[model samples]
Target: MSSLTHTTTPANTPVERKATRSAGRRTSPNALLSKGVVNALLIVAAFYTLMPVSWLLFAATKSDRDLFSTSGFALGDFNLFANLHHVFTFNDGIYLRWFGNSILYSVVGSAASTFLCIATGYAFDTYDFKGKEKLFAAVLGGVLVPTTVIQLPMYLLATKVGIVNTYWALLLPALVNPFGVYLARVFSEGYVPNEVLEAARVDGAGELRIFAGISLPMLAPGFMTIFLFSFTASWNNFFGALVMLNDEKLYPVNLGLFMWNSVTQQQPEYYSLVITGSLVAVVPLIVAFVCLQRFWRSGLTAGAVK
Candidate 1:
């Protein structure tokens, strides 16, 4: 007994060291492969989306001879100005009219529609009305229905009401986007806290006053999101415009370009004009996005966390 010395070693020490080492090197080949695949898909998608726009940029700068003669991506003679002059002057400067029409439809329609959607969404969220969820479910169902499905019906109704072939035909339908309503409802739930609304109401604020003062300020991000969506949709409303308006004066920039492009089969000169018009048509959207993208992104992020 005197000759033996007791010794004890902790068994868990070795195991803990092993686990630490493994944790430090835990990145797996499968995860790396998945990341690589996702990156590759994103690159492919970006290329597909930008390819046409890149072609338009190059094509817009070329003259008729250069456009057909050179490669689609090749630099052409610097004829952007000449092309633009021709585009503006052709048909008594009708391009300007189209631009103006687009501004009116996009700006005014978006403003009204965004407010309407926001108000409806706020009501759905804050107030406990009968059939509210059912009504909202119906609106969601409307979003699944393709817009083209309703186009003909909307056109017929507009015709019956004598608003077809006018700005009202396109403008009115844009104010009724079910998707916008859904988006607004989601945004309201996220951004506009019920506690704030209740506090305002308890302070003797009327419902309209509460919405206008407290709720509306909180819902700014949603407003901008809906406005941009509505504006872009109205700006590119080619099919609806085609069905409703025969007058070139009422054409939006997109439809105007389409009409010009249709003539390129017989008249090659229209190619440069159409390309240039298309490039110009893209400017408003770019500007709107640049100015408002942060709001949209913030809204989305806020909604996600909520």
Candidate 2:
């Protein structure tokens, strides 16, 4: 009665604690709305990205009449096999020749380009030279320049060298990929540690041996990445092939397809062949990426880790 009994009360009761947790667990309306919007945008982006490819897949399966009359995305009379037969047998199987040439240019040109880039990049990274930085800066400048700007000049040079309209015209120009060199240099810096090279040197290993046995393994991923990039670029090099080559026998698939597509306006029968040829032309690229994606991923990861 005289004084208040000194008593302590809990800051929060069980009911209040439960209510607090419920409030904490509940997501705000704005957050849910934002999440839904993000998901919707991604769905729309995916559909937009894939729509053309889907249309191409369906179009390649249709006959000329069906290609024009039927819905662009709908399945037609299942003429893919028939169209492929035509693509292979048409014009004395010229498509096959073009396909072979495409493979030749892509494989040989990309392989050689990748090797040269590796060696050059490794040299720049490992060895001290008088004007290394300046040379590399020049290469970077080349990367910024557009290929189209130099196509005419390259053609003129090819003509002067008497390699115009030849396979060398196509292959030689492709071997000098500035971007590939830049990428390889970056990869070498990350993957090839100096200590390892020094150890090898001390242990009686020559530069070539150290590079071939040790450095090359670590740089495998980089090599694969460069090869894939060069291959794709060479395969799709339409303008360069157009300007440098006139011989139908040396034409890559891109120029060959462009030639077919140009005539499709007057010769409507070439429509299915063109579509089918394009579909076939891209299969190898798809296969290549699928096969080498693991190596590419590893290479990227190695760079990140290093």
Candidate 3:
């Protein structure tokens, strides 16, 4: 029995050592140290990104005097309600008008932009039109060009068309998003199967019917993505609005807040209003993302799959 046991132990010793080494590697101090470092970096990044938002939130609760005097992260007197009342009441409630205009611009403009992008992209994906690639390349080049650079040209064109300083001025330019077209084309290629389209054609479905009845449902996620992108872009657009709008009534929330911020240079009392209004301005965007998070996530995942 002793001789048999000795032989078995010798044979199993190497296997036991190998298993121990693997287990050690998996739970090694170095591996754990690296993981700790990665977690730390992620935390730092999150903190950095959230810091300004946090400061804004805290600042909004303070009075004008407290805004500058109080510690940035510390809460001052709870005057959020008062500040909101002041914001709505100030300048005969022009801020509310600005907010309403922003809503109209973002919702209507983004919907238009999304529809145009999807139609254009679908055409590119499915049709064999002349100059399709060249036209698409031009659109792609537009994406690389900064909006600031084109703003002057667009302003000039708007002047030629006599649409400057009007609702059309903001909405029309917002609708021409090159990147949205690119994304929509990618989504069309991935999500819309050519076989399905061919089958629809075989069934005598018109092009419009195929798109509306079949393709739209499959492209719902993509539509949501493009809408969100366009909405955010339109809502936060300041420079274009600044250039196009001389009328205070036409100003979006961003520009409205900027106007108030500018005034704070002379009248320090406007400081609290600016902070509070800024916080209020951010709420719609947050609400949009939260409400559509499920659709947004699914769309992003579907797009990434291909």
Candidate 4:
């Protein structure tokens, strides 16, 4: 039995054992350290991003005196209702008009933009036409051009067409989103199948009918994504409205808030109203993202698969 045990243990000398130990220590320690560092960094980033939003929530509940005196992160007296009342009831309820205008512009303009983008994208993806590539390239180039840079030209065009102070000025520009077109085209190339289109064609389906019935359903999520993007962009648009609108009645919520902020310098009481208005303006964006987040995720995955 002692001879058999000795023969069985005749392997794994000191050098072999040392080498195995060395490899285990080298690989395991480095991998664990890397994972730990990554987790720490992610936590830090999340905290940094959320801190300001947290501050805003607390700040909105405070009065003007408390806003300046109290620590920004601390909860103040709950004056949210009073502040909202002032925000809505002030200036003969001009804020409500601005709110209504913003909603109208965002809903109408974003919907139009999404439809146009989907149609343009579908055409680019499915059809072989002359100048199609050039057209798409031009659209992408337009996306690279900042909206601020074209503000003067857009203003000039609006003035020439006598649409300058009207809803048309805002809605027209919002409808022509280059990024939405690009996103739609990319999504269509993947989410929409050539075989499905061919089958629809073989079934004597008209182009408009196939597009309305077949393509639109597949593009629904993409449309919603573009709509959200357009809505946010239109909602937050300050410079465009600032430049285009002279009539306070026509102002969107962003510009109206800016006006309120400006007047707060002269009339300090406007501060609480401005804060409340800002809080109200932000709610729609939050609601939109929450409602459509699932669709956005699915759309992204579908696009990636193609």
Q: Alpha carbon lDDT of residue 83, candidate 2?
A: 93
**Residue 123 Cα positional deviation in candidate 3, in Å, after optimal superposition:** 1.3
lDDT of 1 by residue, 96-193 (tens): 99999999999999899999999999899899978989999999999999888888998889979999889998888888989999989999999999
TM-scores of all candidate predictions against the true structure:
0.91, 0.87, 0.89, 0.88
lDDT of 3 by residue, 1-306 (tens): 455443344655888999989999999999999999999999999999888888889998888778878799999898888989999999899999999999999999999999999999998999998999999999999899989888899999999999998999999998899999998998898799999999999999999999999998999988999899999999999999999999999999999999888877799898888888888998999999999888787777665766
| Distance from true location, Cα of 232 in model 3, Å | 1.3
lDDT of 4 by residue, 1-306 (tens): 355443455478899999999889878978889989999999999999788667778878999899989998888898888888888989899999999999999998899989999999999999999999999999999989999999999999999999999999999999899999999998898778999999999999999999999999988888888888888999988899998999999999999999889988899888888778888988899899999998788767666664
Query: Which stretches of candidate 2 lie above 4 Å from their native place?
Result: 1-42
Better of 3 and 4 by lDDT: 3
Instruction: Kindly report which residue stretches of model 1 are placed more than 4 angstroms away from their true locations once superposed.
Output: 1-26
RMSD of each: 3.1, 4.9, 3.5, 4.4
What's the true lDDT of residue 90 in model 1? 90
Q: What is the per-residue lDDT of model 2 for residues 110-166, given as tens digits with 9 covering 90 to 100?
A: 999999999989999999989989999999999999999999999899999999988
lDDT of 2 at 304: 73
Ranking of predictions according to TM-score: 1, 3, 4, 2
Task: Look at candidate 3 and give me any clashing residue pairs.
Answer: none
The lDDT values for all models are 0.89, 0.91, 0.91, 0.89
